[model samples]
Target chain A: MCTVCGCGEGDTKLEGQSIHQLPPHAFIRGAGGHHHHAHTHSHAPGMTQARMVQIEQDILGKNNQYAARNRQWFADRAILALNLVSSPGSGKTTLLTETLTRLQGNVPMAVVEGDQQTSNDADRIRATGVPALQINTGKGCHLDAHMVGHALESLPIDNGGILFIENVGNLVCPAAFDLGEAHKVVILSVTEGEDKPIKYPDMFHAANLMILNKIDLLPYLRFDVAKCEEYARRVNPNIQILHVSATSGEGMEGWLNWLQQQRP
Target chain B: MHEMSLCEGVLQVLEDEAKRQNFTKVKSVWLEIGTMSGVEIEAMRFCFDAVVGNSLADGAKLEIIEIPAEAWCLNCAQSVAVKQRFDACPVCGSYQLQVIRGDEMRIKELEVE
Candidate 1:
C-alpha cells in the first residue's frame, strides 16, 4: 500500500476523476428503412459546422503552467529548490541523509521524496530530525509539477532555505518533467558504467550538475572518472561535475559549499 | 507511463479549448512530435486511445507529424540532420554537434465541432 497518496497496490485508476456524459445524438432511419444512422450536432443553430481550430500549444503546457506557479511560489518565499535525480541504487537517499546530518541546525531544510512504492526514504530523512514528505508515485515513473505543488501544501518549508526534491529512481521520464526546481543535480555512482551519461544523454543534457558518488569504490571498480566527465561534457558542455562519497564523507564539503552558494 | 500523463495534458487542452471556442466535441488532433523528443510514437498512440475515452475527444483520431532532429556541427560550421541526442556530426564526424531544432511536442491543430 502506498502511504502518501493512499493508493494501494494493483490499483490503476487515474486521479481527479470527472463525470462525463455523451452528447445528444439522434438516430435517423434510412429511406429504405433498413438502417439507422446516428447524427450528432450542436443544439445552437449555425454552430454545428466542423471547423479546424488553430491550437498551436505545447503538449506539456499544463504541467509547465503548474511548474511556473511553483517557481513563483518558491521565489516569493526565497526558497532554493533543487531537484536531485538519478538511477536507482545511485545512493541519493544516503547522500541526502548525510547532507542533512552535516548541515543540521545550520540550515533550515525540508525534503520531498519520490518513489514508486514505500516511504522508507522519507522515514530515513525524518530519522535525521529533518522534515520530510514522501510522494509515492505508484505506477507513475516520475513526479509532475501538479503533484509537487500538492506536496508543498503539507510540507512546511522555511524561508531562505533549501528544498531538496529527490525524484524517482528513473533517468528518462524525469528529464522531461520540471518540478519548479532551480537546478537539476544528476548523481552518477562510480560503481555504474562510466558511459552512463552518453547512454542516457537526455538526462545528462537536462541536468546542470552531475554528482559522481561512491568515489570510495573507485579502486574496487573499473569506472573511469575522466571518461564519465568527458561523456557528460559531450552531452552538456557546461555541466558541472562533482566527485563525492556519501558513505566515507569524502567531497561532502564541496557539495555543501555548492548548496550554500545556491541560496539567496 | 509518462505518455499517459502527456495524453492527459492534451485532453486538458482540448477541454479548455472547448469552453473557450464553444466546441462540444473533437473529431481529430494533430500533434507535432520531434524525433529527439524521446516520446515513442506507438506508446503515445496507445495512451491517447486510453485517455480520450468518455471525454469530449472520445474516439478522436490522432495524427502525428514526426519532426526530424537537427543539429549544428561545430567542426563543419553547418546545420546537419541527426537521429539521436548523442549522434556525431554527419559531415565532419565530430561529436561537437550542438542541437538546434527538434524536441518539440506540440498540438498544432484540431478538428472540432
Candidate 2:
C-alpha cells in the first residue's frame, strides 16, 4: 500500500471503481525525483504578499481516514481485529502460533503478517492450518491501516472471526500508525528491559494490553515483572498486563478468554 | 524512515490545500511538531526535501515550530515542562504526570501563490 498516504498499495478496485485512490504525493514522486526551487519564473519581486492559508491540519489526517474506514469494516462484520506490536523477536509470532494452535477448533481466525522482507512468518502461520497473508513492507517500518484494509479483502475471515494483523517488529514506528484494530497488543519478553514501557512510552501508551511473554524463561532471567508492570501502568494506567509463556502454554486460557470477551 | 512517510503526509496536505485554495504553487509551509510527538526534527527535515521533491510543495521552505513537551503532575496539581515522556514531575518528582500538550503534529499555515 502507499504507506505514506495510507492508500491501497496496488491498483485496488472494488467492482469497477478504484478504492482509496492514490494520494497526491504519489504523483509527486511519480513525475520526478528532484526538488524544483526555481520559483523565480513567477517572482513578482520582494515577497509578493504570498497568501497565507490557515490550514491547521494534522499530518496523519489521511491515515486516520483510512483507519476509520477499516474500523467500520471490522465493526460491520463483528470481526475482532487486533494489531500485535512489539520490538523485534518479542515472541509475537510464537504467541500467535500457539494461540492459533490451541483455538483452532474453538474459533475462526486469519492473520496478516507484516515483515520488512519475507513470507517466512506467514508460512509459519499457515503451518498451523489457518489462512495467513504476508505483507512485505520492503523499507517500510510499520504496517499502516491502508495495507491491512487491502489484506482484509483477500483474507477469508467472516463475521465473528478474529483477524490478527501482526505489525512489523518495531516498537517506535508502529505506535503512530493505527491499523483499525479493536486493540493493540504489545508483547514484551522477559529478556527485554523492564523499563521498556518508559523508554518507549508512545507504544505502551497506544497499546490496550501488554503481554509479558516468555515467563518460562523468567527463572533464568533477571527481568522484574512487578517493576515492568509498574512502569507500564505509569505510562498507561489502564493497560492490562498478561504474563504468558507461549513455550509452556501458561496463561493461554486467559488470553483465549480475553479474546472471547471481545467478540461481538 | 517513518519521517519519510511523515514528509509525504505534509506534501499530501499541501496538495489538497492547493486545490481548495486554487494555488498553483507552494512557497513555504509552517509545521508545529511537539517534542513528545516522537518525531525527530533532524530526520523529518532530511526526508522533507526528497518527499516533496516532485510534489506541489517542491522546493517549498519548511519552517518547523517546535513545541515543548508539557505534562500535568497529578501530585503537584500543575502543568510542568517535560524534556521527555518518562520525566519525573519537576515539582513533586512523581511519575503521576499526564501529558497536556506538545504531542501534536500539525500544519499551522502555508504560504502559497
Candidate 3:
C-alpha cells in the first residue's frame, strides 16, 4: 500500500502522491461531456491478474512543482510577477506597450512574451526600451511553468521590480498552467461578448483581476459596461476590475496606480 | 484544446511509475477528472491513444471518473453542488462561493503487470 494515501492493492506501492488541486491560477483545459464510468478492459494475453498499483498523482504535479520553484525565486528577489492572458485581438499588447511606456522610469520592469510563432510581441515590448524575452512555443499552445522558469534566465528582471508574462493569445489552454506569477490579470475587451465570463468561467475564476480594455470605443460600440462587469462578477465574486483604453489613455491612471501598489 | 498536453502529463506519470514500481507494461489507467476542470473526455481519450502508440502504455485502457465540483455558499453558508465554475449557489442563487472540491485531474489507480 502507498504510505501517504494508502492507495494500492499491490505489495510494492509507488511513493509520492503529488496530486493537488489549487483554487485556480487558470490552466490546462479539459472540459465538457458528462460521461463518467469506471473502465476496465481485458488484460494482455498471458498477463493475468493485473496488480492494482495505487499511484495517486495529479496530472499537473510536474508543472506545479516547477511553478513552486519559480515562485520561490520570485519571492526571494521580492519581484512582483504578473501573468496577462486573453484571447486573440484583445489589445493586450497595445495595453502592455502603453503601460510600459508610461511607467518606464518610475519602475524597473521586464517582460516575457509567449506566442506560438514569431518574436513580434517581444520586439514590440523592446520598442519601449524595456528588456523583453520572446518564448516561441512552436507547436505548443500554452506557456507552462517550466518554460517560464527557463525564460527567467533570458529576461533579467531586477529585484523589487515588476515582471509581466504575456501568455499566448489563448483563453483556454493558458488557464491550466501556473507560471508562478503573483497575480493573473485577464484582459477582456469590451467588443467581445458580455457572456465571455460564462463561456470561459475557469479563466475568469482563476484570475485575480479582469481588465475591461478599449473603453474609449465603448461610446462607438453597443457594449453594455454594467452588464459586462455583472457577468464577470457572477463568475468570480472576488475579482477586481478596471476599465481602460490604451489608445486614448482613458483610465490609465488607475491601471498605473494598481501596478504601483503591487510593487514589493 | 489543451487536452493533448493534459494527456501527455498522464503519460509522463505512467512512465515514472513503470520505472519506479518495476512495471514493464501498463494495462489500464484510472483518472479522476473534475467537472469544473474543463477537460473534455473524448478529446482526452483521443490524445491518450495517439500519444501512447509505441510507448510503454500502448493499448492501455483509459478510465475516467468524473468528479463533481462542490462549493460553499457564503450567503447561505451551505455546501452546494457546482457543475461548472460559473454555477451559482443552488440554494440562494448567489455567486459568492468558495470552491471546496473539484478543479483536479488526479491519477487515482492503475492496472499494470
Candidate 4:
C-alpha cells in the first residue's frame, strides 16, 4: 500500500488514481531557480566541456511551493485545516466521525481522506452528513500538497470551517509531506507500542499535537500513559498530548475544545 | 518507499534545471542528505537509478553527501551532535534539543554537459 513509490502493499488497483491526476489548472507556477555557480572545464579538443553546476535546491521544493499556495488559500478563506497523521488502525476515522457527529449542526466541517486504494473512509465521513473527498495515493505513500490543491476544487467548504485532512496511515512518509495544514496531529493508539514516538520520531517530531487514542482500553491493557507521554515529549518537547477514546467518547470534550480553539 | 518519490523529485529538479540552464544531458548529481532527514541512503540510491532511467539524467552518476545531524541543546547552551531524533544532550542529558541543522535533502550540485 506504499503509494509513495507503489511497492510492497500488493493491492495496487489504483481505482482513484486516474481521477486525481487531472491537472491543477488554477495552480500558478512561480519562477524557480537558485543562484548557481557553474564551473566548466574543456578537457579535450572538440569535446563537450564538463561543468559542475551549483543547483542548491531542496528536493521537496516543488511540494513546498504548492503547500505554500494551499496555506494561502486556507488563510484567505479562514479555514482551519488540520492534517491528521497516524499509523493504520489508530482510530483516526473514528475520532473524525465522533468529532463530526458532535459538532454537526454547530460548525461547518469538511474532510479529505487519504488512502492507498479505497474510498471507504470518505464514505464514512459523507455518512456523517459532511462534505468529503477521497484522495487515493495509488502506489504513493503520502498526500502531497498538489493532490490537496486539486481536491480543494471539488470540496464545498464555508469560511472559518474545519477541514480535516486524514493522511494516509503511515508514520514514516506522511511526516515529510506538508499539505498546507495549520497543525499536524499525530494519533497513537494504546493498542500500539508506547514507544512508537521514539521509534517513529520523525512523525512525532513533525506533529504539533499527539492524540493518544483508544484510552478507554487502558484498564484492560498494560499501556502506561505517563511513559508514552514522556517518550513523546522526548522527541517533541513542545508537543501537546491528549488522551481520548473515539469509541467510548472518553476525553472527547477536551479534544473538541482544542479543535474549537484552533478555529480562526 | 518515500525514497522513490524523493528520487522522482531529484529527477524533476534535474529536468527543470536542464531547461533553465541549457543542459541537455546530466553527467552526475550531488545530493546532500542529512542523517536526520528520515531518508534511507540505500533506498535513495536504489530508487535513483530507477527514477532517472531514460530521462535527461539517464546515465548520470549519483553522489550523496551525508550531513551529520546537529542540534542546539538548550540545557547545555551548546551545539551537540545527534544521531537520532530522540537523542538527549550529551553533556546535560536533557531532551530539550532544538535542531539547528541536518534535516535537509537538497540538490547541491550537478555535473552536466
- Compose the digit string of candidate 2's lDDT tens values, residues A148-234: 777777789868899999999999999998888899999999999999999899999899999999999998988899999999988
lDDT of 4 by residue, A89-181 (tens): 999999999999999999989999999878999999999999999988777889888778778877899998999999999999999998999
- Estimate, for each residue in B1-113, the C-alpha lDDT of model 4 and write its tens digit: 48977887787788789899988889899999999999999988877776676567765789999999999999889999999999999889999999988898999999888
| Clash totals, every prediction | 0, 1, 12, 6
TM-score for chain A in each prediction: 0.84, 0.86, 0.81, 0.85
Candidate 2: stretches off by over 4 Å: A1-49
Tell me the interface RMSD of every candidate, in Å. 8.9, 2.7, 8.5, 8.9
DockQ scores of all models, one per candidate: 0.48, 0.61, 0.37, 0.48
Candidate 2: C-alpha lDDT: 0.84
Identify the leading candidate in terms of DockQ: 2
The true-versus-predicted C-alpha distance at residue B41 of model 1, in Å, is 0.5
Highest TM-score against the true fold, candidate:
4
- lDDT string for model 3 (B41-113, tens) is 8999988877666566777899999988899999999899988777789999988988888887999999887
TM-score of chain B of 1: 0.96
- Candidate 4, chain A: TM-score? 0.85
Query: What are the runs in model 4 whose C-alpha is more than 4 Å off?
Result: A1-17, A20-47
Task: Return whichever of 3 and 4 wins on lDDT.
Answer: 4
